[model samples]
Target: MRLNPYGEDPVRLATSLTTSPPLTAEELTARCVGAGVVLEQAATADDLAEVNVFLGRWLRVVEASNPQARAALLNELLAESSAYPRLTDHAGDGWHIHYRDYGLPVARLLRALISVGTALHLTGRGMHRLSRCELTECRNPFADFSRGGQQRYCSPTCANRDAVRRHRAKRALAS
Candidate 1:
């Protein structure tokens, strides 16, 4: 069975939802579709609620202070969401491994996908790869997909903003 390219995308998707959550099931589904997730079932308000709950739990995993803590949290999520891996080309997009059982509701599918993807990302990259932005006032979480794995901000804007703030503060102190 081929593992889906669950490296960066699922983490990024989870980050996006946590940083700026969609308000409706349609919006959430649209965002998932936009991110190239295949949705075989109709999204509903219940799905939205479920996603919110799942993301909340996911955020706990993200905020875990150390590798052991993170791993434990992730393991719990994995147990809840995913199953033994299997291969499928249900979408016809390509043959890939699925960590979830077939015919799950959209909410459950997302939980499984995100949990497994986050596991792959952290273990494949580094345990410290996922983190909140370093910007003092902007604490959005992010996935470090940078070539150097040194990404510390959720966006370039936040990085630049913090940089400018630091520069001005330094100049003022120097003056």
Candidate 2:
């Protein structure tokens, strides 16, 4: 069964793209396809440029100071990118819901998908679900799709490093 693209997956994709952005349209298309996004149109230079712009706006949503701010930023993205939800089988996989108008360019499709997916994620989960890594040195954004919803670091490596640092600090204090 196909996973819900408008849930955790797009959030994860957003975080992935934000963390290590593609340098070219081809690279962007490769990454999106790897993340299960189907690109009906050819990826172009304009698509790359547009995606860069969209990512900047998406970052604001991630970095919002409060839920109200987050909602406002996200709403702006949704307004700019998404349309009324409709069923589509553009990839011929099956009839699935799309939050964008048909036949958009690659960048527009990504913008619409990511924006609406983020909205669904924040509303369905908690507003605090999207955040940067708690480790101060690594500020990579992440979507907390954990069952417990308590993810703090972007990766286990960062989490382990922080834990080690905390342990060392506590040991030093005791000594």
Query: Which candidate tops TM-score?
Result: 2
Task: Show the colliding residue pairs in model 2.
Answer: none
Q: Which tens-of-lDDT digit does each residue in 81-161 have in candidate 2?
A: 999989877888888888999888999999998999999999998999899999999999998888898999999999999
lDDT for position 9 in model 1: 82
Model 2 misplaced stretches (Cα beyond 4 Å): none
Q: Each candidate's TM vs. the true structure?
A: 0.95, 0.96
What C-alpha lDDT values do all the predictions have? Answer: 0.90, 0.90
Assess the local accuracy of residue 161 in candidate 1 as a C-alpha lDDT between 0 and 100: 100
Q: How many residue pairs clash in each candidate?
A: 0, 0
Error of 2 at 162 (Å): 0.3
**Candidate 1 lDDT, tens digit per residue, 39-146?**
888679999999999999999988999999999999999999999988788978678888888888889989988999999999889999989999999999999888
Give the Cα-based TM-score of candidate 2 against the true structure.
Answer: 0.96
**Number of clashes found in candidate 1:** 0
